[model samples]
Target: MILCCGEALIDMIPAKTEDAGTGFVPHSGGSVFNTAIALGRLGTRAGMLTGLSRDLFGRQLDDALKASHVDTRTVVYSDRPATLAFVQLEAGHATYTFYDENSANRMLAPEDVGALPEDVLALYFGGISLCNPPAADTYLELAERHAGRCAIMLDPNIRPSFISDIPAYRARIARMLAVADIVKVSDEDLGWLYPGPEALMEKLAALLKAGPSVAIMTRGGSGATAYLRDGREISVAAEPAQVVDTVGAGDTFNAGVLAKASELGLLTPGGLAEAGEAEISDVLAFGAKVAAVTVSRAGANPPWREELAQERPPA
Candidate 1:
C-alpha cells in the first residue's frame, strides 16, 4: 500500500451560484488528500495519515476518502476546525490563500502519529505539510524514522510564502531528499529550491547525487523527465486534454505514478533502486496521462479506473 502522509483540508473553490454571482464552494482537498483519492480511484491500495477534525468539513473530507476507497484508519482526530484553502483561478490556472492557523492539520505533533501497518510499502510525503511547523517536524521525523523500512516519495510543491523559516525549511527538505528513493519536483520548485544559473539538468543531477535513485521533474507544458542517479534519463510528452483549472493535476499525476509503480511491482525500496529507464519512463507517462484527465476537468477530480485503459501488464 502507498501511505500518504500530510494535511487534509477543504479547498474553497471559485464557483458560480444559481444567480451567476461568484461564490466559493467547499471541495474536499489538500495535496496529500488529493493524491490518496487519485490513487484509490486508480485502484491502488492507498491510505492517508493526517489529523482531521470532527467538523462538517472534516466529515466531508473523511467521506470523500472513504468514497474513493482510501483507508482512513490511520487518521488522527482532533476537535479543532479544518484548514481552509481559498483558491483563486485565473484563466484555468490556480493559486491559493490558505487559512490554516490553529487548524487540525497544523496541530499534529510527532506523538499524535501512530504506527503504520505492515503492508505499507511506500510513503508519499510533501505539500504544505512540510511547510507547517509542528506538523512539518512530525512528518519529517516519521519520514526519517521510516526511511529504512520502506520506499519514500517526496514532492516539496514549494510554497515560499508558507515557509516562515527558510533555513530550517531548507534543512528539513535537504534531509528528506537524502532519504527519499523517488523525488518528484516541478521546474518552479527546483528554481525555488536551488536558485541560480544552474541548468535544469544540473539541478536534477544534484538531486540524484543527494540520494534519491530516481528524480522526476515536471515542466508545466513542456512535459516531464525522469533522471537516474547513474546518468540515464527518460522524458515523456504530456497527454493532450481540454484545459480546465489545473488544481490537482500535479497531485493526480503523483497518484498515477504511484499506481503504476504498485502495478508494476516497483513500489518497493529495492524496486525503486533497481528500476530501469523503461519502467520509470512508463510511470512518468502514466502520470502525465492521469494529469491530462484531471486538467481536462474542473477542480481536482481524478479519473476512476473505468476512465483509463489497463495499467497492469499481462501475466
Candidate 2:
C-alpha cells in the first residue's frame, strides 16, 4: 500500500446558484487528499494519514475517500473545525483563499503520525501541510522515522502566500529533500527554492545532490523532465487536454507516477534507486497521461482505472 501523509480539507468552489448569483460549493480536496483519491480510483492500494474533524465537512471528506476506495484507518479524528479553501478560477487556473487557522489539520501533532503497517511500500508527503508549524514538523518527523524503511516521494507544491518565514521553510524543505527518494517540483517551485541566475538544469542537479535518486521538474503546458541521480535526463511532451481548471493536476500526476511505479515493481527503495531510463520513461508517461485526464475535468476529479483501460499502452 502507498500511504499519503498530509492535509485533508474542503475546497469551496464557486458555482452558479438557483437564484443566478455565484455561490461557493464545497468539494473534498487537499493536495494529499486528492492524490489518495486518484490512486484509489486508479485501482491502487492507497491509504491516507491526516487530521480530520468530526464536522460535516470532515464526514464529507471521509465519504469521498471511501467512495474512491482510499483507506481511512490512519486518520486522526478531532472536534476542531475542518480547514476551508475558497477557490477562485480565472482562465483555467485556480487561486485559493484559505481559512485554516486553528483547524483540525493545522493542529496535527507529531504523536498523530503513528506506526506504519508492514504492507506500506512507499510514503508520499506534500502540500500546505508542509508549511505550517506543528503539522509541518510532524510530517518531517514522519519522513525521518521511515526514511529508509520504504521509498518516499516529496513534492513541495509550493504556495508562497502560506509561508510566513521563507528561510525557515526553505530549511525544512532542504531537510525533507535529503531523505526523499523521489522529488517532484514545478518550474515555479524551482524558482522559489533556488532563485538566482542559475539555469534550470543546474537547479535540478542541485536538487539531485540534496538526496533524491530521481528529480522531476514539471512545466505546466510545455512538458515535464526527469533527472536521475546517475545523470540520465528524460523529457516527455505534455499530454494534450482541453483545460478546465488546474486544481489537482500535479497531485494526480504524482499519484499516477506512484501507481505506475508500484505496478512495475519499482516503488520499493531498492527498485527505485536502481530504476533504468526505460522504467523512468514509462512511469513519467503514465503520470502525464493521467494528469491530462485530470485537467480535462472540472475541479480535482481524476479518472477511474477503467476510464483509462483503453488508453493504456500494451504490456
Candidate 3:
C-alpha cells in the first residue's frame, strides 16, 4: 500500500476552443491527487490523505477518485469550500492559477492522518500542501514519524507565481527533501530554485546529503536524469508524441515510476535506498512511456493498466 498526502482540488480547464475562445474546462486535479489516482488506475493499492468539501465540485472530485479506485477512507470532510485552480495551456504546457486560501484542503490537520497502516510501502507528497502552514507541518510530522517505516517520495512542483517568499519556500522544500528517500523536480524547477547549473548541482548535492538516495531532474522534451548518492547517474529521452496538454503529465510520471518500483518489489522501506542504477533506469523509462501516452491525449486523464498492457508488445 502507498499513502499519498496533499491537496485535492477542482481544475477549471478550457473545454471548447471555439466557444470559450480560451477553451477552459474543469477537471479533478491536485498534484498528489493525480499521483494517487494514477497509482490506483495502474492497479496499485493506494490511499489518499486530504481534506474534501461537501460542495458539488468536491463531490465530483470524490467521485472521480472513487472511479480511479483510490481509497478515500482517510480523506477528511470539511464545511469549507474546495480549492479551485484555473489551468491554461501556454506553449503546450499547463500553467495554473490557484485559489486555495481558506479552502478545505488547506485546512488539513495532523490528527487527520492518525496511525498509518503497517502495510503501506511508501508515502508520496507534494504541491501546495507544503506551502500552507498547519497542514504542511502535519505532513512533515507524518514524514518524520514514518521515515524509517516506509519510503517517502517528494515533488515540490514549484510554481514561483504562487510563492511569495522564495527563501521560506526553499527552506521548506529543503526540509521535506531531508526526509524524502526520493525527490523529483523538473529542470525548470531547478533553474527557478537555483539559478545557475553549478549552483544547481551544488544545491542538488546538498539535498542528496540530506538523505535522499536518488534525485531525479526532468528536462521536458530533452529528457530526464537521475543521480544516485553512490555516484552513479543515468539519463533517458522522452518518448516523442503529439502533445495535447502537459497538465498532470509529471504527476502521472511520478505515479508510473512508483508503480513500476512497486511492481519490481522495490517500494518497500528497505528497498528504496538500496535500489540500483539499473532498477532506477527501468522505473524512469516506464514512467516516461506512461507520461508520453498521457500527453498524447487531452486533459489530465492517465492510462489504465489495460491501456498500457495493450500498448506494450510481447517480448
Candidate 4:
C-alpha cells in the first residue's frame, strides 16, 4: 500500500446557477487527497493519513475516498471544521484562495500521527500540508520516521502564496528532499527553489544532490522528464487531450507514476535506484497517459483502471 500523508479539504468551485449568475459548489479535493483518490481508482492499494473533521464536508471527503477505494484506516478524526479552497478558473487553469486558519487538517501535530502499517511499502507527502505550520512539521516528521523502511516520494506542489516565511520553508523543503527517495517538481517550482541563470536541468541536478535517487520535472503541456542520481535521464511527451481544466493533472500524474512503478515492482527505494532506462521511461509515459485523462475532464477526477487499456506487462 502507498500511504498518502497530508491535508484533505473541500474545493469550492464556481458554477453557473439556474439564473445564470456564478455560484460556488463544493467539491472534495486537496493535492494529497486527489493523488490518493487517483491511486485508488487506478486499482492501487492506497490509504490516507491526515486529520479530518467530523463535519459534513469532512464526511463527504471520507465518502469520496472510500468510493474511490482508498483506505481510511489511518485517518485521524476531529471536531474541528474542514479546510476549504475557493477556486477560480480561467481558460481551464485553476487558482485557489484558501480558508484554512485553525481548520482540522491544518491543526495536526506530530503527536497526532501514528505508526504506519507493515503493508505500506511507500509514503507520499505533499500539497498544502507542507506549506503550513504544525501540520507541515507533522507530515515531515512522519516522512522522516519512515524514510528508509519504505520508499518516500514527495511533490512539494509548491504554492508560493501559501508560504509565509520563505527561508524557513526552504529549509524544511531541503530537509524533505534529503530524505525523499523520489521527488517531483514543476518547472515553476524548480525556478522558485533555485532562482538564477542556471538551466532547469542544472537546478534539477542540484535537487538530486540533496539525496533523492530520482527527480521528476514536469513541464505543463510539454510533458515531464525524470533524472537519476547516476546521470540517466528520460523524457516523455504529454499525451494529447481535449483540455478542459488542469485542476488535478499533476496529482493524477503522480498517482500514475507510483501506480505503474508499484505494478512493475519498482516502488522500493533500492528498486528505484536500480531501475533501468526502459523501466523509468515506461513509468514516465504511464504517468503522462494518466494525467492526460485527468486534464481532458473537469475537476480533479482521475480514471479508473478499467477506463484505460491494459498496457502493463504480466506480473
Judging by TM-score against the true structure, name the best candidate: 4
Ranking by lDDT: 4, 2, 1, 3
Which digits, one per residue and each the tens of the lDDT, describe model 1 over residues 136-236?
A: 99999999999968889999999888887999999999999988989999988988888989998788878888878888898877899888877777899
- In terms of lDDT, the poorest run of 10 residues in model 1 is 306-315
Off by over 4 Å in 4: 310-313
Q: List the residue pairs that clash in candidate 2.
A: none
Clashes of 2: 0
Highest lDDT scorer: 4
All candidates: TM-score:
0.97, 0.97, 0.93, 0.98
Number of backbone-clashing residue pairs for each candidate, in the order shown: 0, 0, 7, 0
| Model 1 ranges with Cα > 4 A deviation | 18-20, 310-314
lDDT (0 to 1) per candidate: 0.90, 0.91, 0.83, 0.92
lDDT (Cα, tens digit) per residue for candidate 4, span 1-315: 999999899999999999999999999999999999999999999999999999999999999999999999999999999999999999998999999988899999988877778899999999899987899999888888888988999999999898877888999999999999999999888899899999877898899999899999998789988888888888999999999999999999999999999988999986777988888888999999999999999999999988888565447
Q: What is the per-residue lDDT of model 2 for residues 240-291, given as tens digits with 9 covering 90 to 100?
A: 9999889899999999899989989899775665888788888888899899
Q: Which ten residues in a row have the lowest lDDT in candidate 4?
A: 306-315
lDDT of 3 by residue, 94-142 (tens): 8888998888888788877677766777999898888766777788888
